[model samples]
Target: MLKLIESLIRYEIRQNVIKERDYVYVRNQLFNLLRIEPTDQDISYESIGYPSDALDPILDILEEQHILDGSKVARDLFDAKIMNVFAKLPSEIEDLFFNLYKKDSKLATDWYYNYMKALNYIRSERIEKNEFFKTSSIYGDVEITINLSKPEKDPKSILAASKVKSLAYPKCVLCAESEGFAGNPSRDSRDQHRLIELNVNNEPWYLQYSPYTYYNEHAIVLSKEHRPMKINQKTFENLLELCEQFNHYLFGSNADLPIVGGSILSHDHYQGGNYVFPIEKAKTLDSWKKDGITYNLKKWPLSTLVIKSKSKEALIKKAVSILDKWKNYDNADLDIKSYSDDTPHHTITPIARIEDGFYTLTLILRDNQTSDEHPLGIFHPHADKWHIKKENIGLIEAMGLAILPARLKTEMAFVKSYLLTQKQLPDEALKHKDFAQKILNEHQIDKDNVDEILEQAIGEVFVSILEDSGCFKQNKEGISAFKSFIKDELI
Candidate 1:
């Protein structure tokens, strides 16, 4: 039942019913919620009347409220009692979160993200060192950080695996089961791991620092129960709800499908933190206004629109409406097909933020259409630009920072050497072979400035790759369709 309390506290916090670290208050509230009156000696509760009809959870909204144990109405309560003490683990570093919230509400999340980074907990298992590369671009400065965080299996361990029993104990790395579990061969090392609790739309979701942080204060939001990632009106509601709490942070989810989404589609989650994205910096231009909702076109290559409003409800409504249109939106001329067979080919990666008393959402349209030439996806990175970034341009990349593979560390060095000396490409450098001639054709390079030229070239390549991911081409035809869509104001 400790798992139940841990899960429920996370649920309550995510639901915005209670702030973290208010155990006595939460403990008392539980008395009323679970309908279990505390004994007269239980002096902690009965003073304040919280648990005051917090809204029903997503389960009940779907008409699947589970009360099979003797027909009890849970009143949106948990399955465990907070006061039940039979030697359970104390909250991990949550005491710190509580006190920080008292001094300053935003300080909890701020401190936690910063603390994780300082402890090297964020980069502990994955990155041996932080390696970053940057370049200037028309939109802004484009930075690509090489992630050498992949967990490599030891040769001895791989050989011993057949002799040992493979277990699915924690289910997945993101599961809360790893919160205090010991490390094993198959799973990641989580010795220094920690998760900050957060509520999203009356459901339980957790906010934890991303060890593979691509941006400052980078973090991930995961669901309490292991479930598949989903996108719906509830998702928009949660994003806005979370933005209200973490007013300084930007939160967004990836497309649920592969190719057009994130690396972890199996677990329902969102990526958030107190960092700004380049797309966020793009000025609102060629705009459309309706019901006081400002729909401005972004300057980035990816097809995007920033909708700003003072009314949170109005903006959420607009987002859901636009998402609907984009889901069924069919523009064959622009090569956007919503559905071919039973699979959906179109979706939206929506991001939310609160700025200057107005709520803003950046909606990125995505389409997954694979062709023989571009078998990955016609909307993904093209062949010419594949040498730099061959992976999917998910939420992080969509936000203007590209996370290239670990191989680029060595590959870029070889390319840099080639640029300094006009020597033929080595036989071992096959992946980056043809790419050199293209680079030489684009720029007249010399040793003195070759390094700077290569940096600029990489930034240009990132921009082009993002543009390739755009649902509508950035040319006249694509822009026309985009303008037409907003002009219609489908949402």
Candidate 2:
């Protein structure tokens, strides 16, 4: 089955390559077949040839193979095959084919018609959901804005301000909502002392400490608005300008659903900085160089791909197209509904390559759910989690990265704690817990046979918090330890 798929793909690539090579001859033959006036008859007279009446034989063979019917289908299929075959020929021979069969070929005419139909279908689909943005001039324009509301310094005042209500954990005043406040001083100290020195007076474009500092020089780019849509060409070009000006690589995350752990205040933003420190390291598996494009397969991702390209325009276009295809496939598949978060988004990360004048254009797809695994995998420590134990965390730790747990233990704990204090869990929280539990069960973890013995203990604490606030108050030390582990080993 895989070989058959590869053959189909090769056929498509061959068609494209041929069209690119013998474009002039193909165009002249196509025009003659359609009885259209040539732009220059002198050139057409020189290029055109007698047509080959081979459509009938090809159609008969296809019909025998059950790939065609007596209707226009047979004729259409034959024409497509002819075009594909013509495309594979050398330019000189392709010109001869065109001149020989130009006026006499119904196959070429049908092929042209079918090709236009396919092109139209593609264009229509691309514009179906994006017509408004594409058609409107004003809607496409964008401006960046930043909000610099540094939190209060006094702990009491900050704690008081952190008492804002949250649907996820209404009763917990210092939930993840207070993450910024709890770590703000350390972050600020790092900014004022270490990060500022690194900035080296880089002008208005300054540096800030990233909330998640898995990598050195990690910082978020703020827009004035709290909400923004797609990362447009202007933002990308400006980011590239910054890259050139600073001579540093920039990495960014998308809103709605961020892959690189976005934690802003429901705001529009981008992120970038230097890549001096190692975030995730994996062995390079294979490398290939061709036409200014470098292909690489890394051990971590276990996938084949071009790591960098000379043509930025082509690279971006291809990456966006692949992501668009993935989104379309996700939308069509019921099992992968979570992959599409009711919005389309992209993240472009620039990396300094080993080869000069080239950079790794990392294209990250952003949405509510990342992989098939649950997002909570972010908190799974190597020592405790059963999955990590079974898989050997040494591999991941050696790579210097973390996986978000497929279970929602942290979120569950938060909800249960809130419920114990407030008397009831929110409907949404309960639903998420149920869904997460279902996934756990599918992985063979159930109440009777817990997948991880530790998870059961953690689950009991979560249940206790929902049932009685006194339980959470008694287990404060355990909660602190778990949170600390999450901070150090995961995020």
Candidate 3:
């Protein structure tokens, strides 16, 4: 059966791998691939010793194309090719993914991610260069991913993207209008892009994997209607619903406001994938019971409240209640503002995880109040930390992974060279000199140990970035302020 499925996949690929891949009969053999269903021939992968996956032949062809060279980006390009086949060719493709879920979710999701990769939608080189560091902080032993994935946008392309004179097409990329969008100076061809229609509590939504997957099988679940992001009971309900469908994956949302929100707040969506984060391992530091639901505070720097409950309703209800309360609850002494003038100013970055027949929702309390001294959100990364990451600390970063810009790679290399031999700095290195000098002065870096020290320095900065994003300081005074709030307001 597996062999036949592999053969069918290959045949399907041959049919569309070069030309326009999408056709009415693109996935004619999908249903037959399911062993439980019918097939062209009454055959199976059982000569008794055959590999059950039956993909060896197709893999051989991929190797011929050098797509299997794991260390380089070509292997990822091959992955993109296969995924393009999957995305462009599958019949009733939406349900095909769901059926894969019914058959083997891991297989289905793995394929989906591969397809996203093939599109070059998610650049593999970026994922390949990611530097991981496990550092100790008040949040315990936290692991951070230094994101070197994204390439800088071209100036011409940026200018072209800015002059979008029409919304007649996708209001933004997240809009369903982009399903088969043709390429333009600003927009790329979406002829091979695909989305799976899914129903969450009978409410329709669409699922698609992110091309630049920051972690394993990173996916973006977008709403049917393009709308501003809203965090409420419905958001929790939707996240839980996705968990029920793809329980192997976890789902999270960025806050709805700027400074702490996602880059795309114009469209309502949530990010889900098989990736694990340090926040997942964070143990509960404090908890209190209210209506049979236990709200636990994570010991991390970010003010995360963990709600653990076996009952979905209880978790949702309790989360919404606290969300509403937190929006209005504020203490001047703590410098936490719920609002400025009539503008509303409080939200939560919510994440949903299910295990042991229980639902655990982690909510990071967010306040986007800006001050004269800190024009960005007061809790945002201050100027000192801006040298590392100046972008918003969205849901992914708040969870303990740092998606630093790609420029850091070149800049860091320059800094390392200058420290090792006092070599002439490049024009770009000039901007980073102040930061590099501070490091040189502190560590007195020498050639023998420059690499090790610089690597650790970046990790240390990551910890500080998270701390800057935290509403509560990691210091004893901030801890006291946090506890005071719980005692005075939450409990």
Q: Which numbered prediction scores highest in lDDT against the true structure?
A: 3
lDDT of each: 0.70, 0.34, 0.71
Looking at candidate 2, the ten consecutive residues that score lowest on lDDT are 131-140
Q: How far is candidate 2 from the true structure (C-alpha RMSD, Å)?
A: 27.7
lDDT of 3: 0.71
What TM-score does structure 2 among the candidates reach?
Answer: 0.34
- Report residue 349 deviation for candidate 3 (angstroms): 0.5
Candidate 1 to truth, TM: 0.78
Residue pairs of candidate 1 with colliding backbone atoms: 13-199, 14-198, 14-199, 14-200, 15-199, 122-211
Across residues 1-491, which tens digit of lDDT does each residue of candidate 1 receive?
Answer: 22233344454444333466664565556546444555434232122111211122322332343331211122111211222211123264577776887777578887676555433345433454546677877777777777777434456445544455676767777887666454544444555466766667778888787767777778788888888887778788888888887887899989877898998887888888888878888765488688979888877788898999999889888888888888888887877888988888888888989889989888998988898989999999998888888889899899888888777778878887887786765665557766766788888888887878877777788999998899977788888888888776573
Off by over 4 Å in 2: 1-159, 162-215, 224-226, 229-238, 254-261, 277-281, 285-291, 301-306, 331-355, 365-367, 370-491
Q: Which stretches of candidate 3 lie over 4 Å from their true place?
A: 1-91, 118-121, 130-132, 141-148, 155-164, 288-291
Query: How far does residue 47 in candidate 1 sit from its true spot (Å)?
Result: 49
Model 3, range 1-491, lDDT digits (tens) per residue?
34544444444344333233442233343342221354345333323112212334545554565545322232332333333445544345565567777888777787666655544455565567777667665566656566666444466456656776655577788876676555454555554577877888777788887756777788899988989999999999999989988889999999998878999999999999997788888877677876667777778778887888889998898788879888897778778888888887889999998988889899998888888988987888877777777889899888887787777777888989988887788997787677777778888677888877787677677778777777777678777777676656655
Q: Order of all candidates by TM-score, from best down to worst?
A: 3, 1, 2
Candidates in order, TM-scores: namely 0.78, 0.34, 0.79
RMSD of each: 14.1, 27.7, 8.5
